[model samples]
Target: MAGFLTTHVLDTARGCPAQGLTIALYRIEGGERRHLRTLVTNDDGRTDEQILPASEFRIGDYELVFQAGDYLRATGQAGDAPLFIDEVPIRFGMNEATHYHVPLLLSPYGYSTYRGS
Candidate 1:
């Protein structure tokens, strides 16, 4: 699975999977951003499926935006005026056929992401 890109979201404040959270995938081409797809997290706090298949992997700059504010509001984890970070864009290169496991540790006020195995 080295050629695949995957992600998981965990709500640190709640200590559970951040189900129903919205995420988006994008690729930069010719200085224009293209919307690859939008996905909602499953009960396991993971995308319904892999964002990008291994066969379709390519070497380029990619971004993953996690809709934290809306998720918190809908789940009542945060208030309507939640000081949530709406988006977290992760820019990276697919230099080779490698699996990119991007995991997000999130809270109402902050979030963190990193390359995972």
Candidate 2:
């Protein structure tokens, strides 16, 4: 009965978890997007809690936005370099009342995400 959404981020370029990175979630309703919440990653590159609480989890489409540029820039590696992918947005849908774990592997120029445990 306990089901929710979660996420983890990794800085592939740096070979470590992306700490202090910012992330946001949005719910898509009728083609319009509504903001859910924004969180900064902790030292482990994860939010303190589930992104979507079990009580609020519903069957619908959602999008997660990662502030890749800021994360890269914060590391001081992207200095004076034009960011190729500033914001990485991932859109997905949920059809079951199960835990959705989306983890992101990222670099200054690219990122990848997938459904995880």
Candidate 3:
């Protein structure tokens, strides 16, 4: 899975996967955001499958939106206006057969992401 878009969410505050979190994938087409698909993280804080299959990958600007606020509210971790981030958007490009591992370390007050292997 080194040639696909994958993600994992860790709840730093709770020290576990941010399961049940909604993630949306989008691509910029004609200077606008087009909805590609949506997925929910599993018990392991990862998508059930690879987001962008290597065979169908293309070079473009892509976005991954994480609904952390909703997840926190639903999990009773915070209110509608959580102190941490609400939606986390990661923008990147796919120019070759490269694995894009975007993992999020989330807390009630902050979050961080990086380009993983």
Candidate 4:
């Protein structure tokens, strides 16, 4: 099998999937970040397609930036100014050609991520 990257966001505070959330993927090389693509969460809080398909997948460092602040504000979870949790960036590396799942469990003030199948 070939490797690819996928992700999803769940609104832990609301006890449901985080719809309409924005996600940006970046590839890091030579100590610099290069913008790859931007994706939006569907009704199920998942991208319609893999963020990084095998055709473009590589073994290196990468980052997935979730626009949590915007989603929080839209869902009325953000309070006042200076939100506690804004953009959530998860950095990791792909060392093998296999499936990679990075999921976010998010709330208004905190978030967590893990590798899934």
Please report the candidate that would top TM-score against the real structure. 4
Error of 2 at 84 (Å): 0.7
lDDT by candidate, in order shown:
0.85, 0.91, 0.84, 0.95
* lDDT score, candidate 4, position 7: 98
Please write out the lDDT profile of model 4 over residues 29-54, one tens digit for every residue: 99999999999999999999999999
Candidate 3 vs 4: which has more TM-score: 4
Better candidate by lDDT, 2 or 4: 4
Q: Rank the candidates by TM-score, best first.
A: 4, 2, 1, 3
Clashes of each: 2, 0, 0, 0
Better of 1 and 4 by TM-score: 4
Alpha-carbon TM-score of each model against the true structure: 0.91, 0.95, 0.89, 0.98
Output the worst ten-in-a-row residue range by lDDT, candidate 1: 79-88
Tens-digit lDDT track of model 3 for 5-47: 8899999999999999999999887789988889999999999
Candidate 4, superposed: residue stretches over 4 Å from native = none
Candidate 2 has an lDDT of 0.91
What TM-score quantifies how close candidate 3 is to the native fold?
Answer: 0.89
Question: Which of the two candidates, 2 or 3, achieves a greater TM-score against the reference?
Answer: 2
* Residue ranges of candidate 1 with Cα displaced over 4 Å: 80-82
Tens digits of per-residue lDDT for model 2 on 4-109? 9999999998899999989999999999999999999999999998999898898999999999889888897575657787889999998888999999999876
Winning candidate number (lDDT)? 4
Pairs of residues at least 3 apart in sequence or in different chains that clash in candidate 2: none
